[model samples]
Target: MKISAVVVTFNRKKLLLECLNALRNQTYPLDAIFIIDGPSTDGTPEALLECGYIKELPPKKGNWSWETKNVIYSPINNKPIKVYYVRLYKDVGGSGGFYEGVKRAYEEGYNWIWLMDDDAEPREDALEKLIRYMNLPGVIALAPTVIRPTGEISKPHRGILCFKKIFPMIQIPLDESKYKSNQPVQIDFVSFVGPLIKRDAIKIVGFPKKEFFIHHDDVEYSIRLRTVGKIYLIPDSVIIHKENIKKTSLIKKRFLGKTIYRIPYNKLWKTYYGTRNLTYLGRIYSKSKFKFYFKLLKRWAVSVGAIILFDDHKIKRIQFITSAYLDGLRGKFDNEKPKRILYGGKKE
Candidate 1:
């Protein structure tokens, strides 16, 4: 099988290098590596060319939205692997990068495309093990165990999908007992991080919706893939989620008895996209139109209440989410706004 690895990166140059090195050291041979760089200003492009890890591979093409560069890395099998790097001119988030990378890899005759973020470092045997499950009956896409850098584990592969009580969402528990071996187990959802997906799956269900922008795009894509085939979680296949280790997001007290938290104004952009995308998904997968509208109102009421009670810049949060709700209703999406760093009520 012609295997290609796709990594999407922004300004995280340091971690991006580590991730590329990890990919180069994989036990399974990758035919090519496709990097979708978001035109990072941190000298990421120059760093890739002058990467200290690999030697002497040079760029032989003109720079463009998709610049192709050659990378030389030696595998334990005593062969040099040539990897391809593509830098994107536009910053299209993770979703857009995957859409482009997957499309190109498919067009270039790759049988399988392994998708990952710049911060996801896979174990040596990850690709080898994931490839073992592809030909199994009904297997469509495969992914690895996602562990935090601290070794705290998360199962991106196995998840419960629900659209009944509230919005379209996932319920997850990283139960070790459920994964006793490297045997492939079918799953409801899986993230793009370290997932080895069949090109045929893309041909059938299509690439992820770049319109969702980032969050929930994977879930949305997985949902469509379910219509054609099964997605599997390989127990022994593992990758480290080095980026969001020990990260926390806004959580309402009513959900899990956790204390209500104050959300910063800058983070509201994420809320805008998540709210819009999930509502869009919920509208699509909801049981009925009446149920969808009822849940939508309940969602707004609860969200507005939480913002008023715990968050700062309450009016702006309301405005942002309200705009998101309307946009989602009208099926509109784009790069909303550039993130602005705020400190002590002052924009940086």
Candidate 2:
């Protein structure tokens, strides 16, 4: 079966090179590799050319037009792999990058699409492992176990998004036992890190929501995917997630018998998108309208309380949190407002 790999990247040039090299060394070679660059300013485009990943950078068309360049990477005794480099004039975020990448690969008639980020480097056997189970009945997608550089599994990427309780949603990641077992484990959610998805599944649930811009888009897509068929976690297939470590500390205090902690603001823009997207997901998923609004209020109350109690830049944080929550409730997909808050522009 023909399979293509889609890698979404931003400004992480060094990490992106490492990831591409890993793909080059895969035991089961892919028919094509699609590089979706999020208009990185750190000379990522030039670096891709320097490494011979692309012959030349395509000229800019327009803000929404992503230009593409194609090349064939022919190894000594191995089959040549087609490389498609798409450089966007706009920063469409990870969600948008994948949406475009998958759409391109699917439209090319690839039977399967392997999805990942520039920060993820799959083990040489990763694709081979997943392909071994491609013919399994009722399986729509299979993903590798995401591990850290330290060789520990990154738990959040593979898990069950539990709705056992109406008020709170819990994500229960695969336990150590499940990872150790030889059997494939059925899961409710998997990230875009290293998942091999069937074209049929894409035709059904459709590409990820580009409107999400960034956070939780995978989760939202996973919810839709689970409706059509099964998503499995292949324990043997592995990929290293080299995401930049965010340096932030927790504000904690002993209250009653437990320690109440608040996460410090690392990037307020990320907080805005995450809050807004999550709130939007709640609105669409909830069966009861009253319950959705009630949850939204509770979410805002908690966020406002945390900003007041622990975080610095109270006014700025409160403004972003309040605006994001409201925009989410209204089902608005705005890029400018969040950018204005993150950079140094006044609220619009």
Candidate 3:
């Protein structure tokens, strides 16, 4: 099989190198590795060149361009892995990087595309285990169990999206016991971490929505993927996610025996994109307009309450949240507003 891997990276050069090294040592070798650079300013290009990963830096071709380089895996093994380095003019976020990477891999006629971020390093046998399930009946994509460096399962990386009344559209992480015997557990949602997706599936659902910029891009993509075939979580196939855990900025309160997380003022910028994207998804998935708007109103009320009770920068946060909900309802997709709000930069 023509198996290729796609890695999306931003400003983290060290993490990207670790991820690439892990890819280099995979038990089941890959034919190519696509590096989607988010036009990083952290000397990532120079570092890659220093490591002999790429012979030359790719020229900027307008806003987006790519250059291909071939480097032998090692002097002893002498396996060649083609590396395609794609450079963007600006940081369009991981969603845009994956969109570009997947499109290129598909166009190159790769049978399967392994997708991940620069922070994720797969186990040596991860790809081999996933390859074993390629012929499984009606399987379109397979994901490895993602674990933090501390060996705890990363809950958000693999889950089943629940649409029940109690937890509507919430993602429930799979129980470890279910896949403990090395069995593949069927799941409706998986993140971009080490998921091997078949080219045929991409042909049907198309590439990921690039406008998402930062959040919930995987959920939206996974929802579309469910229309084609099953997505499985392989327990034995593991990847270590090395993302630095940030300190929680949200206030947590137990209400009615449920923990409610309230967004803080500083994190409102992120909340905007997440709220907008999720609201957009709800708009697409909800059967009734009344229910959709009702749910949206509840969310807005919660935001207002959070601002009033536990947050600062009250007016600005509310304004951002309100704009998010409204833009989402109107299906207005772009990162211009959020950029202006966060960086005080004008839209291009």
Candidate 4:
């Protein structure tokens, strides 16, 4: 299959290099590699130039979109693989970067697209293992077991949201024994950390909601992808998530085998997107606006309270969340160019 590995990156040039190196050493042959670079002032552009790349595909004529012209090489067993570097005009957040990367891969006639954040580094055989299960019926996307550099398992994020409102995230271990073969286990959701996606599924579900800009975009996209086919976890396919240490919260068990987790909102940016996206999501999945509106107000109120109590810039946090709440409520979206956020530049 024609597989395109799409990596969305920001200002973390060092991390992006580690991620690209891991991908370059993949056991499976990579037909293409795309780096969807958000504008980085941290010498990322200079670093790319220093890496020695050639411009293979020029930007489309009469298009105001991001340019995808540069190329790098990955030599696998004495063969050079082409890698496409796509530089956006500005930082459009992770959502916009992924949307552009995936859309381009789909339009460029790739059969499958491998997705990941630039912070992640996959095992050499990760792509091969993910591809082993892609041909199975009812499987549209396959994800790798993500782990911290310390070898501890990272978050799997297979949560169901409709019934229990905001629930604690449940993570499953990456059991290598279960992956003795190419087994497909169904899941409710998976993060976009390291997943190989079928372009056919993208054709069916459409593009991800880039309006999300950052947090909850994957969760929302997973919900939409579930409509088409099952997303599977390939335990043998692993990736080292070279990410910041994730904070844990109080885990409270609930009825019907559900749990309520007190996951910490990283900062005001997370606070804004999580609450806004939750409010927006409630509107989309809820059968009744009357029912969703009550939940929305409750969540929004809790958001405001949380910001006032925890955030350093409480007032500004509240303002950002309030804008997101209102916009989400009104079903407003303008992803062509995101308005300049007041704080915390752009997120991944």
Query: What are the per-residue Cα lDDT tens digits for candidate 2 across 137-189?
Result: 89999999999999998998999876432234435676777898797889988
Q: Whose lDDT is higher: candidate 3's or candidate 4's?
A: 3
Single out the weakest 10-residue window by summed lDDT for candidate 1: 338-347
By TM-score rank, best first, the candidates go 3, 2, 1, 4
lDDT (Cα, tens digit) per residue for candidate 3, span 214-251: 77899889989999999988889999999886547667
Query: What range of 10 consecutive residues in model 3 has the weakest lDDT sum?
Result: 162-171
If scored against the real structure, what TM-score would every candidate get? 0.86, 0.89, 0.90, 0.79
Q: Give the RMSD in angstroms, all C-alphas superposed, for model 4.
A: 6.4
After TM-score superposition, the amount by which residue 124's alpha carbon in candidate 1 deviates from its true location, in angstroms, is: 0.6
Q: After superposition, how far is residue 89 of candidate 2 from its true place, in Å?
A: 0.6
lDDT of 3 at 286: 61
Off by over 4 Å in 1: 52-64, 166-168, 171-174, 245-259, 310-312, 337-348
Q: Residues 125-185, candidate 1, lDDT per residue (tens digit)?
A: 8898888777889878897888887886766445656666436454354466667764777
Give candidate 3 regions above 4 Å deviation: 59-62, 74-77, 165-169, 248-267, 287-292, 342-348
Evaluated against the true structure, the overall lDDT of model 2 is: 0.83
Show pairs that collide, candidate 1: none
lDDT of 2 at 73: 54
**Highest TM-score: which candidate?**
3
Candidate numbers sorted by lDDT from highest down: 2, 3, 1, 4
Where does candidate 4 stray beyond 4 Å?
Answer: 53-74, 158-163, 167-182, 246-270, 287-295, 306-317, 334-348
Q: How many steric clashes between backbone atoms does each model show?
A: 0, 0, 0, 1
